[model samples]
Target: MNDDRRVYGTDRGEDPRPQPGRVYAELVGGPLDGQLLDVTGWTPDAILDGAALITEAGAYGPGGRALYDPFPGDPSRWSWSGDTP
Candidate 1:
C-alpha cells in the first residue's frame, strides 16, 4: 500500500505542511474554505480560468461541485462563486 499521505497542501509526515517549491492557492469560502490547491506548474491562463472543485458538502449535498474563481488582483487566492449540480 502507498504510504504517501499528501492531500492538497498537507502532508501526514513529521512536517505536515506545504513543502518548499510547491505553489498553492487558498480556497476562500464554500465547502472547501481554507483549503489549499496545488497550482504548481499551472499557467497564468489556467489560474485565471479557475476551477470547479468537487465537494461533498455542496449546496445540494453529495456529488455536487463548488465553483471558485480567482480573486481579482490576488493570484494566490480563489473565492467561492457558487455551487453546481
Candidate 2:
C-alpha cells in the first residue's frame, strides 16, 4: 500500500532500486501439516532481505492454521490456477 524508491549509484544516471515489502497474517483456524507456504509476493529479483518466510516448526492460530497475519494479507484476495480464481 506504500511506494518507496531508492537510487543505486551516487549519480542520478544509475537505475532506481525498489524497497521491498512483505505481507503478514494470522491464521484463524486450520490444520498443522507439512505445508510449504508459497509467499506469492517475492519474485526472482526480490531479494529476501532479512528473514526466511517458510519454516518447518511453525506457530499456530486459534484452531491450528499458522498465524501468518503479521502483514495483514486478505485471504479473499488469493487466487488459483487452472482457469482462474
List the global CA lDDT of all models: 0.79, 0.28
lDDT of 2 by residue, 27-66 (tens): 2222322222333475433322212223223343232222
The candidate 2 region of ten consecutive residues with least summed lDDT is: 76-85
Cα misplacement distance, residue 7 of candidate 2 (Å):
30
How far does residue 44 in candidate 2 sit from its true spot (Å)? 17
Query: Across residues 37-83, which tens digit of lDDT does each residue of candidate 1 receive?
Result: 88899999999999987777989788788988899999898999999
Could you tell me which residue pairs clash in candidate 1?
Answer: none
For each candidate in turn, the TM-score is: 0.78, 0.17
Model 1 regions lying over 4 Å from their true place: 1-16
The positional error of residue 4 in candidate 1, measured at the CA in angstroms, is 17
**Runs in model 2 with CA error above 4 Å?**
1-20, 31-73, 76-85
> Model 2 TM-score?
0.17
Most accurate candidate by lDDT: 1
Error of 1 at 58 (Å): 0.9
